[model samples]
Target chain A: MKIAIDLNGGDRAPEEILKGCLEFLKNHPREKLILCTTKNEPDNLFDLNHPQITVEYFTHAVGMKETPAKSKKEKPDNTIEGTLRLVKNRKADCAFSCGNSGAIILNSVDVLGLKDPNTHPSLISFIPLYNRPPLAVFDVGALGNYVFNAELYFAVLHETVDIYTKLYGVKEPEIKLLNIGTESWKGTAEHKNIYRMMSDSLYNFTGNIEGDELLFTDASVIVTDGLTGNIVLKLLESFNVLLQNFRNFKDCKFDNNYLNFLIEDFNYETIGGAPLTGVNGKVVIGHGKSSSKAVRSALELCVKYAEI
Target chain B: MKIAIDLNGGDRAPEEILKGCLEFLKNHPREKLILCTTKNEPDNLFDLNHPQITVEYFTHAVGMKETPAKSKKEKPDNTIEGTLRLVKNRKADCAFSCGNSGAIILNSVDVLGLKDPNTHPSLISFIPLYNRPPLAVFDVGALGNYVFNAELYFAVLHETVDIYTKLYGVKEPEIKLLNIGTESWKGTAEHKNIYRMMSDSLYNFTGNIEGDELLFTDASVIVTDGLTGNIVLKLLESFNVLLQNFRNFKDCKFDNNYLNFLIEDFNYETIGGAPLTGVNGKVVIGHGKSSSKAVRSALELCVKYAEI
Candidate 1:
């Protein structure tokens, strides 16, 4: 199996990306990697002589501030577009990017194509819970403000969860609609309609769930629009960072280990990156500031998803 | 100043509510309390004979599960309605309820009326930040699923912030639109339009702010539709509860005091209740499961708002 990596994607690109590629190579010796970089010559940190890895050079790199649609159209040789091409042409099994989430998503949809052209892909992230299986939150920010049909989004989410359940060996994954309240009458008309649709379907529809339910509930999959999902994802991310800063308090009486453990649940690095599911090909997008370990985890996630 | 307290509201009604009334009476000797209850006789927990307090009995109580609008229409004697009636009839300066937030909002709007009937009320909650001033998040549950005008919402938020700044002696409270992203191009067309409108207005508009920015940003008042605000508020509340459960880990090495301090920041009980702003009369709504301390804080909040 082969996986394509975008070296020009993340904030700490080239060096961290190269190191992560090495880590992936060390862990999965037989799995082939196609690394795409904007640099003509690879970074000195990476031993390109590794037999399992091949490097592809791209002339252009998309900046974080660049509009995804415009960048995709204007820069054909951009690392994100180039990486997606590899997956599209069957040169690689899957693609990974830690760059601009928006750019990666747009370029992936444009190059790799969507499973259903009528529907947009959703960004799905796995959040680890204390005692239960990790919950998957979708549309973390792929569609943005674009009005989407609730039924289509749910259909894509259902199909994505089916693949995830089979791949992870999760038995009877419960699907839930994310809303402000769990009551039947609560939420927008669209949300209520979607809830009813899911309930009538064959999926293990567990009814409506709230944002707080994400951490403690037994539901395996939660669905929402990109706007709400993005806010929820980022809020949790920021809260985690705030908690980590608490460790800096030298005079505090809290146990360091317990504090670390508490913050650990929210650490996104442990989960690596989010997958752009409902697309035709396997695509994973990491945080812009992902560490080398996180990049490696993103690559590993692609491999796991590729197996499905 | 006279503040009305609902006795038959909240999960722990009558007892907790009565205790809170007594606490308020003890703390604010100059403030008179008008206690509304469904019971003919007080719970005996309260010193009803106190010169600062008076009890008014009602025949009906609204359950948390009952529909808010339907309940307001059917049960005119409910504690929420009865409490609001005191303010409407000029018997009480303000009112507090730890019952159903929806019920409080609807009954308050129905009984006391809005400052402007065209402008819907927003549920404004004060979230205590670590180093910075507390952040006020609005539309926590009010105006649910309604297609509200952005201009009206912003107007109400701006007016509310102006009052808050003057009342709390806040110097130049910055107002921001709560969104999925900080970029100008982010969020729905309505959000972007609101951003532009606020920018042109006299209010200190800081453009669109992501959910993560809530914790560390200098923006004093964040505005969003009820659905998003409710989800965000509940998400934080649930996270706090989850963190509290972590205290059960006796073997962990974290400092208990520091851990407690971190958890305390997200504690809803500390803030008492959310004020239903944009209404003609002052109405503060507390969490349904509020303890006596929280209930007391809610009553104190009503007094403070009444002073404004």
Candidate 2:
């Protein structure tokens, strides 16, 4: 499979990005890579002589602070646009970025387009739950409002779960709507409408699940509007940071090993990036401060997802 | 002050409930209590002959599973209704219950009525933050949808904060809307409208705050619709539960002391019951599974809040 990667993305940018690419190439010697970079003289660490790697230099790179839509419209030759064009032209199976997620989503949709115009692209990530298969949380930040139809949202979630089940050899996933209460009467009119739609649809719907259940429940797919999902995701992230700080405090009497183990579940670097699911083309976006390990894992995910 | 107590409330009703009241009475010998109970023969633990305590008998008790509105209407002599009536009649300065929160809220609203007919009562709880004053979270589960007016909600929150500032001797509290993003453009139209209203209003309105900031930000009050607030509150509760489980595991290497300290912050029992704010009467509702200690703390809170 041919995978395109943006070298100008992320906080560590070209250095970490090149190291990740090299790591992926080392593991999958048979696979090909289309590396997009804006630098005239690439970093010395990057092995330009790799036979399976191709370089496509761009004239500009999207800044982290620039508005995504505006930048995409004005800077036509930026890395995000350039890398997506490769996927658009069928030159690569998929594209991956450790850049500003907003830019990635805006450019991908504007360039590669959506699978269906009526459907919005959602950021899908796995939240590892102890003793159960990882729960899939979708639309973490892709769409801010409940703009899509409930039925369409369910269809996208079901399809994503189906893909996971097939790839990971897990059982058929049980879908649950994340709400304040497990009761049918809970949440807004939109939530109730979604619950009714899911209950009536062909998907294996297992009623409503509350936020507290996210850590312990057996539901494989937890669906929510992007706003709630983003808030929950970020809340969890910030909580993990607090735990880490507590573990590192000099006066803390806790055993560092156990604290590390407790925090392992919250580490995004371990699982790498989340995919922009439901888009017409494959795209993965990672954390801005991703380590080399996270970048490598993101590339591995790209390959694994591309095969499906 | 004559404080009303529900004798038949909570998971361990009458027993733990009475124990908590006794604990409170033992500490505050000057305070008066009017206790409501459906049981003809109260538990032996309750000091029925205490000079400061008076018992009120009722024929029926509200069960935990019954619908709040229906139960309040049908069971007029229930513990919640009886206790609230004492407050409505000015027979008690405040009321405390470790009962079904739904029943407490519904009964309080229907019986005592809100300070204003157009106003909705919100469940307000203090979330203790590290090295800072506790943050007040409103509408935790009181109003499920965004049915309350933005301006009225702000006015109520501002008044509550002002009262707290005067009583607690803290600085004027800053209020922020709990939202998906810090950006003014984020969240639903209702949220944006609230933002605008708050900005124009004569209150110390901070911009929108994300869930991740709940634990760390300096904002004294975080406001949101009940659905989102409930989810966020429960999510934090569950996260703390997970930490406790990890601490309890025999094989875990963490120091029990530090783990215990971390867990203490998440303990709802320590702070006792949350107030059903905006109601004309003072009502505090504790967890159903509250222990004697939680009950004691809740009574103490009732005394403190009543003084305001």
Candidate 3:
């Protein structure tokens, strides 16, 4: 299996990304990799002589703050586009990028077209639970600005169910809708309409789940509009910071090991990246400020998706 | 100042509600209370001979799960309406209820009436911070299903700023918009429009604040759509439950004091209730499953608002 790496992506591009690629190669010697970087990158950053590694260069790299639409219209040969192109042409089984999430979604949609235009791209994040398996949250930010509709939400839910089933090896996982209340008649008109649609669907559809029950719910997947999903995802991801503030509030010096244990699954480095599902090609998007270890973990995730 | 309380409003109606009033009266000997309850309540539960407490009888009580519209249309003289009517007719300075939040908002809007028909009623919740003063979060559930509009958002924000200033004694508190990102161009078009309107307004408006920064942000007030605000409020309030799950995951015995200290401010009993602002009268809405202690706290909160 082959995976494409955007070496010019992320805040610490070209250097940390190169180290991550080297780290991945040390672990997986037989797996092939296609590296995409900007031509402006120094030669010292591209010293990998492994036969399994192939290098591709682009003229420009997308900035972290660049608008996705402007980047798509202005920078046609950007490194992100170059990285996704390998997957489009079937040269690489999947692609990974730590660049701007918006740019990645836009480029992935352009280079690797969506399976159904009505079904927008969604990022599936696994919410860690106590004893049970992690809950899958769909559409974290892919369709943030898009209006919520039954058809669009249903398509994304279907794709999420398929991907979640493949990942967990579950025949028909239970799915729940993230809402303000658990009552079926709760939420806006749009949400009420979606509720009815999902209730009649073939999936193992459960009732609505509230924010307070998010971590405790037994539902395998929680479907929500991109706006709410993105907010909820960020809030949960910031758990460590919240705990630290609490620790500081007491002015106590706690052991780092205890804090680490508490935040074991909450660490972004461990999570690596989230897949941009509903697109034709396998694509993994990492955080904007990902470290070398995080990038390496993201590369491993790309390989995982490719192999699956 | 006299506070009107709906004794038949909460899940633990007359008994716990009456106990709360007795508790409040015990603490504040000089304060007067107007207790609203249904005639169906047993005489044994209403035998309190406190001269400071005045009882008002109603024919029916609103159920916790009943729709606000149906309750308002079908039951005109419910306990909740009777309690709000006391505030409307200046018989009481403020009102408190631990019933359905939607029903409270709807009855409050009808009985108390909005200062501006264009502006809907909003709940202002004080989110406790570690070392700093509590942050004011606007529109927690009052306008949950309402569509996003710049004018409506600005109106709610104005009312929040006014009430927050009165409560905290701040001449001009800083305000921020809750969004997925801090960027000016982030979020949906409606958010962008609201952001621009907030920036141009005369209020001490800061830039957009993300969910990750909700607890740590220095901004004194964060204004958001009701749906997002309610979700964030519930998630933060459930911090104690999340920590309990974490402790259980580790399977270790931790001191309850440490857990209590960590969740000291998150305890709903201590917080009491949130005020429904922008209406002609002061209204405090408590949780549906409020205990006697929580009911007492809500009564105290109503007194606080009344005195302010």
Q: Which regions of candidate 3 fall more than 4 Å away from where they truly are?
A: A14-26, A50-52, A244-261, B245-261
Q: Given candidate 3, what's the lDDT at residue A253?
A: 36
Q: Local error of candidate 1 at B214, Å?
A: 2.1
User: Candidate 2, which CAPRI tier?
Assistant: acceptable
Candidate 1 has a TM-score of: 0.93
What is the C-alpha lDDT profile of model 2 across A41-137, one tens digit per residue? 4466455788988889898888765666777778788887778899889999889888867789888888888887766677888775554556788
DockQ of 1: 0.50
Clashing pairs in 1: A9-A99, A253-B255, A254-B254, A254-B255, A254-B256, A255-B253, A255-B254, A255-B255, A256-B254
lDDT leader? 3
* Candidate 3: tens digits of C-alpha lDDT, residues A1-308: 89888888888887788787788788898899889887787786667577889889888889888888888889999889987899999998988888878889999988889999788777987765555556888767654354666677788777778777876677689888887777888777777888899998755888888777776677898887667777777777676566654443343333545455445545566657888887889998887777788888777778777877
The Cα local distance difference test for each model comes to 0.77, 0.76, 0.78
Candidate 3 chain A: worst 10 consecutive residues by lDDT? Answer: A245-254
In the range B139-175, model 3's lDDT, one tens digit per residue, is 6765436465667767777777877788767778898
Query: What i-RMS does every model get?
Result: 3.4, 3.8, 4.7
Tens digits of per-residue lDDT for model 1 on A23-56?
8789797899888877754467456588998888
Measured with C-alpha atoms, the lDDT of residue B216 in candidate 1 is: 75
Q: Give the range of the ten consecutive residues with the poorest summed lDDT in model 2 chain A.
A: A142-151
TM-score of chain A of each: 0.90, 0.87, 0.90
Ranking according to DockQ, highest score first: 1, 2, 3
Shift of residue B106 alpha carbon in model 1, Å: 1.9
